[model samples]
Target: MDQTVSTVIDEDVCIGCGMCVKVCPVGTISMKEGRAAVTGKWSLNCGHCEAVCPVDAVRVMSLDKEQSAFGTFDADHRWLPHGEYDTVQLVRLMSSRRSCRNFKDEPVDRPLLEDLVKIGVTAPSGTNSQRWSFTILPTRHAVIGLAEKVGGFYLRLNRLAEKSWLRFLLRMVGKRDLEDYYHTYYEYVEEGLMEWKQKGRDRLFHGAHAAIVLGSKPGATLPKEDALLAAQNMLLAAHAMGLGTCLIGMAVEAMKRDRSIARFLGIPDKEQTFAIIALGLPDEEYQSTAGRKLVVPRYFEG
Candidate 1:
């Protein structure tokens, strides 16, 4: 197999301060001949060797300097110390964050959605491999169109799921839960499809003004976890910014089953859809935060 990553060291510029050796999580770097060298046994290409090199002697060859953003921030004022905001303020924000199903008819600007994406990507990823991408459906019509396509697919799915043979097949495939859930959904929508598509209510997206889909590389090490982490970051960021958002797993499942829907959403053919968040201005108000019971955990004390 071809080597996906490699690291380089500049012996001439090396101070041999051992920062790279100390910071390497895998212990691949060691001091040899008063210079840092990698053992290559446990190297994950995580770039701690490159980051801790005070004199820039260590280089992670897999990193693309042209494509990467470095020295892009004004560090003096932009970087903050630990006690920036109190715990009470953070708790209030966390308590206020909720899944918003209803939204106003007003349109959200593309720039604001862009800001959410910017913050979302700041989330940490495995091996610093930032393999997340965001697609913003900024218009109400675009969102509704995509929802309609997904809804139509679901309607057909509901029909097929009701058949006895299909249900038996699903049970054989260990999808009894899915089979039962679809059966329940079929009964719910059996009344009238037109009535389900009311003026202000969208069954899939709940009339949100905009939608954001978080995608991951097709073969990433932790695609689903990374994408959902980024999604949560974006969701909380949206809430903090006075915007309402909802995480919709149905959108991801729908896009995965239909290539046409994925293509229409501009998802890369080689990428997988992991998360979708509906974004919009709030149409309703919440008087208080809903309380929840904490799950009890078994302790393993030494």
Candidate 2:
């Protein structure tokens, strides 16, 4: 992790309120001679100091201002204070955003796709190591290209799963992943692959016009969790933008097993792909939000 301090404080404009110093996680900013100053040699570059400053006297040089500028919608640069947003509307959006399998043939605009990536990076990352990466297949043709590679992987996997001897040998070595996959997903995958190859049906992406592959470069504290969090942000944002999205776990699984799929998508060898989002104008609609499964909360009393 590069901890180089990128925080610059305009001393003349600073009110010396110490808000930036108080909010900085790495204590990079401190009050010196009744004014806020960059006193530390290192920083997380998380922009806490810049965000908390009273008079906009602080700026993190490493952070890009263009990232917050959305092409599809006007973004409010002012930060919403705690407890300011409506929770009811927030929860409504959360519950209403369903996994859409049916999508229209109309392709998503490149600007909208770019805006989605911008929305994706707004998610918090572990230790401020914002190593999340996005690879956009901006057209149906591009999406189909990736789908074909992923389909090939599943086809080969089905052949191996057909071999009882290999499955048994793997299970004997305490590796039950193949055996579990064979039992749980073999039949479904076989049917889907056949439909795809013979009838030109798309069971993988469900005919999505576009896709965004989310991943993380090496050295993040929690790469997978960070990528998933960013994925959730993009999913919800897509829903609000009049688009539907689905998490293609099978594509992610295929990529994990075969590195060539990632390479085909132009993702580097060092990065790990975590989520692939299939998105486009939805063809389906629901009347209302549905309830989830019951759950009991467990409190740990120490």
Clashes of each: 0, 0
**TM values, all candidates:** 0.77, 0.98
- What CA RMSD would you report for each candidate? 4.2, 1.0
Look at candidate 1 and give me any clashing residue pairs: none
> For candidate 1, lDDT tens digit of each residue in 197-291?
56434767878989998988755678788898889888887887778999887767778888788888777798888888999998878898888
Evaluate all candidate structures by whole-model CA lDDT and list the values in order.
0.78, 0.93
Regions of model 2 farther than 4 Å from truth = none
Q: Which stretches of candidate 1 lie over 4 Å from their true place?
A: 1-17, 27-85, 164-178, 189-192, 196-200
What's model 1's overall lDDT? 0.78
Local accuracy of candidate 2 as per-residue lDDT tens digits, 152-184:
998899999999999999989999988999999
Q: Roughly what TM-score does model 2 have, to 2 decimal places? A: 0.98
Best by lDDT: 2
Model 1 scores worst on lDDT over the 10 consecutive residues at: 68-77
lDDT of 1 at 34: 82
